[model samples]
Target: MHPGVKTKEPDKMSPPEKMFPVLLQKNYVPQGEYEIVGYLKEAVKVKNAVGQMVIVEPEEFVKGEMKPHESPGVGFGPMEMKDGRKVNAKIWAGTTIKVPVAEAKYVVAKKIAERADDIAA
Candidate 1:
């Protein structure tokens, strides 16, 4: 083989191609099938089973379910509305949630906090 010339056979692919794992955000739920609607350097637009197009953080994987870790920490603060004063609070990963994915329609990639009652107990 010539120094400048390259001659290497490509590897054979199995029946089904392998998919890479997708990196998820703190509050993002990685589950179910996702359609590749768009692509970006940082993330890709994917449609979940609900037909909702959302941005999926780029990491790896094509269609699959994944359980992400808890979200970031958040503190509660006081806030007043026009109606009256209320005990508004900031929220972080207060609980563990299971996100299910059906088809490539919509994506459920968001962090959520557990209920106050659940945490209180």
Candidate 2:
């Protein structure tokens, strides 16, 4: 071992396993299904929209898709909002979106986890 580095003995009971990092930010959507090891980074609050705040942090994930699943029979690509805006199915990894505070608390919390597994067969 190098003089500048420190080393410790392995645990007797548990063997070391390969580990991957995952990020779970507040306003950011997860790319795909991942076995989240732990919080590599904490969520940070950022100003978004009028009188609302959203979490804008990037998280680490392993072996996941950056694009969202499209439903069957959905006409064209991307999603359309009531205000005539388009929401792309492909969200760049580590990107954040501003959501309504109330919706974020209730809806996003539940949906984020399932996003990765929401693909059509």
Candidate 3:
């Protein structure tokens, strides 16, 4: 600890990167809702499976390379919202997040959206 040295802080209020709704498979651990906030610039470790470990590298954290529109995702643990305090989520692979737009749901959503058009007419 150096009294003369000062530390820079992350821009907590900075707008989040472009995000897309993603599905965290119920089968995966620490299941919940998550979004494709953006590709990970730094390498991170995740639980690929029980008793298994996988390191998601920066190069591997890509979008569209794995079948189009679908990108890998990560799960976060609890987080604190208070200011002046720093906290990082206890992250895990959480059964691996295969984040991509579900086409089936898109189809349903399209139909529902059409109703709005009908009402406008």
Candidate number of the best lDDT: 2
Query: TM-score for model 2?
Result: 0.21
- Pick out the ten consecutive residues of candidate 1 with the lowest summed lDDT: 102-111
Ranking by lDDT: 2, 3, 1
- CA error at residue 20 for candidate 3, angstroms: 6.9
Q: Tally clashes: model 2.
A: 2
Number of clashing residue pairs in every model?
A: 14, 2, 1
Clashes of 1: 14
lDDT of 2 by residue, 1-121 (tens): 7899988878778753332232223324323322323222345678877868787775443233332223554332356799997664433333233333343344345654212222412
Q: Where's the lowest-lDDT run of ten residues in candidate 2?
A: 32-41
For all predictions, the C-alpha RMSD in Å is 20.9, 19.8, 20.5
- lDDT values for all models: 0.34, 0.40, 0.37
What TM-score against the true fold does each predicted structure earn? 0.16, 0.21, 0.17
Positional deviation of residue 18's Cα in model 1 after best superposition, in angstroms: 37
lDDT of 3: 0.37
